[model samples]
Target chain A: MAQFMDVHHGMKGITADQLREAHQADLAIEKDEGVHFEKAWADPESGTVYCLSEAPSAEAVQRIHERAGHRADEVVPVPLTV
Target chain B: MAQFMDVHHGMKGITADQLREAHQADLAIEKDEGVHFEKAWADPESGTVYCLSEAPSAEAVQRIHERAGHRADEVVPVPLTV
Candidate 1:
């Protein structure tokens, strides 16, 4: 599977706890989609979230987010060094 | 060239202007390295910068950051859809 970084913006009003809840809720669906969410970071002030995952395609990553009720602002493919 | 998103953290003390200056400095070396920096976003509060670019390898992306005196916290390869 290829790696992808899905960046989410427009989360300015969200609290850290709320963001963590949303993230955990979304992560539950990963197993069904063949996507491995490696890690994630949330910017409390900007309300932006960055998730690092390994998946088959960018669309696959978006689908997971969509299913979780969040839209990915941008999904960028990550190339492996080796 | 493959797309990559280099995520940088640990800028809690950096100002928006200072971050912008650092980003501009790094972008200047991109052309010489055969890297294209498409876009970037900075969070002043957290001092995190996310850069989207197209390059041949993760190492090439890191080399640009290294040359500019900033270390990339993570370099993830982005796969193109078409």
Candidate 2:
């Protein structure tokens, strides 16, 4: 599985709690898409959300986000580390 | 300027202090590249670093990170919000 870091925007006033709820909800169903959401981070002040996942493709990550009701604005494969 | 989210990996065991130092160092010179890094997040256990910036292009973002000595693994434009 490839690793991907996806971004979501336009959530300027979201709370951390809300983000946690949404992330948890997504994780509950992401396995169906061959994606495993490993972690999530949100900047409530900026309205940005980020998710790290291991998946077969970026599309699978987007699909999981869409089903979770917070589709990502961008999803790209991470090619290097450190 | 467009918003970009960049990811860096392979830094497992890095401390938040080191990440902050690197981010600050990058900011000190990013203006020359037309990039403004607004914030950064790091997960030491996962060795993943995420940065949010406003720039003309992803290339500018990559350039800034490269100059900072912690090149990003991926840099993608973020197009949506909420």
Candidate 3:
């Protein structure tokens, strides 16, 4: 399993709960795409959300986000420590 | 090496070159701490710098940053995708 962290920007100045709901909604899509969300965080000040997930590919990650109605600012692969 | 991303904020509205220099300095510290830097990025508008690195522990990551004379806003573990 490859780890990925997706950084999202321009959340439309949404509230924390609202953002959480969007993320939870996105999580559902991720599950459908065979991705597992290990953890997630949102910065209310910056309206940015960071999500850590395990997925086969970055494309799969983007698909999940697209299906959930949010576009990522950047999606980077996380290499495991040796 | 486990890949971790460090998100930094409040860069005092520094320029990209300045931030990059700071990051390069930080990378030297990481190398000394047995960490390998994969990639790093900075957003001038938000004054955010994100770094990808491989390290055994988050504490080690923090130490590298401190040694470089910068503070991290957040450091989240990236779970490998399964």
Best by TM-score: 2
- Each prediction's RMSD to truth: 13.2, 9.2, 9.4
Best by lDDT: 2
Model 3, span A1-82: residue lDDT tens = 7877788877545565676677677777777778876666554545667777789887888888888888788776654221
TM-score of 2: 0.55
DockQ of each: 0.05, 0.08, 0.07
Query: What digit string (tens of lDDT, one per residue) describes model 2 on residues A1-82?
Result: 9878787889887775787788888889999999999877666666777777899998999988998888999885654332
Q: What global local distance difference test value does model 1 have?
A: 0.74
* Fnat for the candidates in order: 0.00, 0.00, 0.00
Q: Which stretches of candidate 3 lie over 4 Å from their true place?
A: B1-5, B8-82
User: Could you give the candidate ranking by TM-score, starting with the highest?
Assistant: 2, 3, 1
Q: Rank the candidates by lDDT, best first.
A: 2, 1, 3
Candidate 1 or 2, higher TM-score?
Answer: 2
Alpha carbon lDDT at B44, candidate 3: 52
Question: What's the TM for model 3?
Answer: 0.53
| Cα-based lDDT at residue B13, candidate 1 | 61
Which wins on DockQ, candidate 1 or candidate 3?
Answer: 3
Please provide, for model 3 over B1-82, each residue's C-alpha lDDT reduced to its tens digit, 9 standing for 90 to 100.
Answer: 6656678777545665676677678777777778766666554544666776688867788888888888787764443212
Q: What lDDT does candidate 1 reach at residue A31?
A: 75
